[model samples]
Target: MAGVHVVANQKGGVGKTTVTVNLAAVVADTLGGTADSSPVLGVSTDPQASMLEWAERAGNELPFDFEQCHDNPKLLGKLREIKQYSHIFVDTPGSLENESILQAVLTQADDVIVPLEPEPLSFNPATRSIERVIQPAGVPWRVLLNNWDPRDGTADLEQTREYIAAKRWPAFNTVIRHYKLHTRAPADGVTVVQYAKNRVALEARQDFFRLALEVLGTGGDGPRHASAVNGVSSTNGG
Candidate 1:
């Protein structure tokens, strides 16, 4: 059974799609199997279909298999038939009003990655989502501090981290800082690994790489696959 990781949160605008796409890229680019026989599958369950658009924009630039499954709740049942895949990354809806969709995705996911912004407003909803949905599903989860401003040494970042720690939530050590290169990806149809010329781009790439490592470590497995490449096979959601 391939590891199923879902990017979900009750609160919107937390960069769920961004994390979903990039982590899938890192896994497909650097981990298991060859790029030609891509191992990672990017599953988009969000009603907005942002991931679908992103895949179209990326074209051959994407490093993993991409799919849009509007019927996300059925994804879990179908995944069992796809044991060949090494990783499955699902991008889910973030609206509090979309609890049913989030619940469905969570029910099927083996793991969840909750990306939280560095703000007070982002914390409560995430915590509630984790407590009400994630814990009940018994799926292991980790929170990543996204959109962090390293220059702003105010208490926001620290307080948020402390809050997570206080609640005994698992989180990643790699903090994804806000960078222009990251913001430019969706617009430019580029992944961090493809942004080879810019230092900040390379830095962003490294963060995702670290995140991939952390995720893979959860299963105590390494990137054991074919030669690394730069492209992935694209597919539609089932």
Candidate 2:
């Protein structure tokens, strides 16, 4: 069985699909996946199927296996039965109308990653999803600050951190900073690892690499997986 990590939030435009693909890609790279064997799998439960489309656009260049399981409860429920992949990252729908799909995925999730923007308006919807769906599922979850721009100063970032801390929510220390590269990735059919080798591209890829380490329990404070990779046993809890 693979560790199922669902990237979910009830609000739109929080970079759920972006985080799902990139995180899976970097983790697969760290695991040294080859052309014939991909250790990571990316699944999309959004009716929009953004992740699936991104994989299609990427052609055969994606580092991990990809699947679209939207409206398919049977597939979502059977995720744990698949043993080939070490990790499975799921991109879920952000709309309330498709919440049942989110619920179905959560039932099999070993961990959940909630992406939240640094804005007051996003707080309520993020909290609603955490409290309503995630909490009930009893899965370990952490909030990730996405689309943060250092140029805009740290006021918004600081305030968002304060909000999460006030609510006693677990969060990642890593912030997925805003970058035009990430915005253009879907249309360009590229992941951070596939970006042109430049300063900005290196920075973009590094962020996800650090995030992947945290998810694998090799770095930072985040949930650990039961599996071993590269002789490292990620067995500790966050």
Candidate 3:
């Protein structure tokens, strides 16, 4: 079914808007094309309007410009008016405690995607937001490790998983690494597909496509439940 998907966090600088803007562009580019002709709704609740800015940069490709909900509370109503769209992607402000923003999005969302950096510091806000805001709404959540540099074993992936284990949060298995393509996505106004053609960028593109499928109940990559050590394969039985 068509419903809202909120990209949120209680902290800042965790690539929240980056994820939202890129995912919207990705979905629009993938499904909203002439073949599917599905309308993908973009809702920008962040006062900064970073996602909205990215949509403007994206130009004519967007089925509709990102709708700015200045009142925040009016989001529910604003969303009600957009019937043509088969999916709604929303971006909320960082470190925000506005009930209306949460209420507006959660009250109607089909699912939620929380984009978090692979650091305990990042998880602090993200985890809390999920516990306090998201769970109460009773919607599904996909915890994305965004801007993650898994190579830094001690500081990044290992510690990240350590934090996830302690909290026992179910996170997405497929991740988009901290590649330049993600940062450059908005400036170039191109989806990763239209931008770089390297292994990393291509992998990220697939991860998001699978993400879209999961959201639409079409399923994604097989469950990501792997055992590792320092972010490496240290579970050898040999």
The C-alpha TM-scores of every prediction are: 0.86, 0.93, 0.80
User: Model 1 lDDT vs. the true structure?
Assistant: 0.76
Pairs with steric clashes in candidate 2 = none
lDDT by residue (3-70, candidate 3, tens digit) is 66778776878887777766776676766444236467678787777776777777765544467774
Scored against the true structure, residue 37 in model 1 reaches a CA lDDT of 80
lDDT of 1 by residue, 71-181 (tens): 645664576457768889989887777778777776667667889998999988898888888778766677889988888885899999888767767677878888877
Q: Ranking by lDDT, best first?
A: 2, 1, 3
Higher-lDDT candidate among 1 and 3? Answer: 1
Poorest lDDT segment (10 consecutive residues) of candidate 1? 224-233
User: Which sections of candidate 3 miss by over 4 Å?
Assistant: 32-38, 63-65, 78-81, 97-99, 151-155, 198-200, 221-238
**Residue range 1-238, candidate 2, lDDT tens digits:** 7988899999989999999999988888888996578999999999988888899999889989988889678999999889999899999998999989998898888888899999898999999999889878877777899989888999999999999878877777788999999999999998888999999999888889888877777787566221222233334331
Judge candidate 3 against the unseen true structure and give its global Cα lDDT, from 0 to 1.
0.66
List runs of model 2 lying over 4 Å from the truth: 224-238
Clash count in backbone of candidate 2: 0
After TM-score superposition, the amount by which residue 203's alpha carbon in candidate 3 deviates from its true location, in angstroms, is 3.1
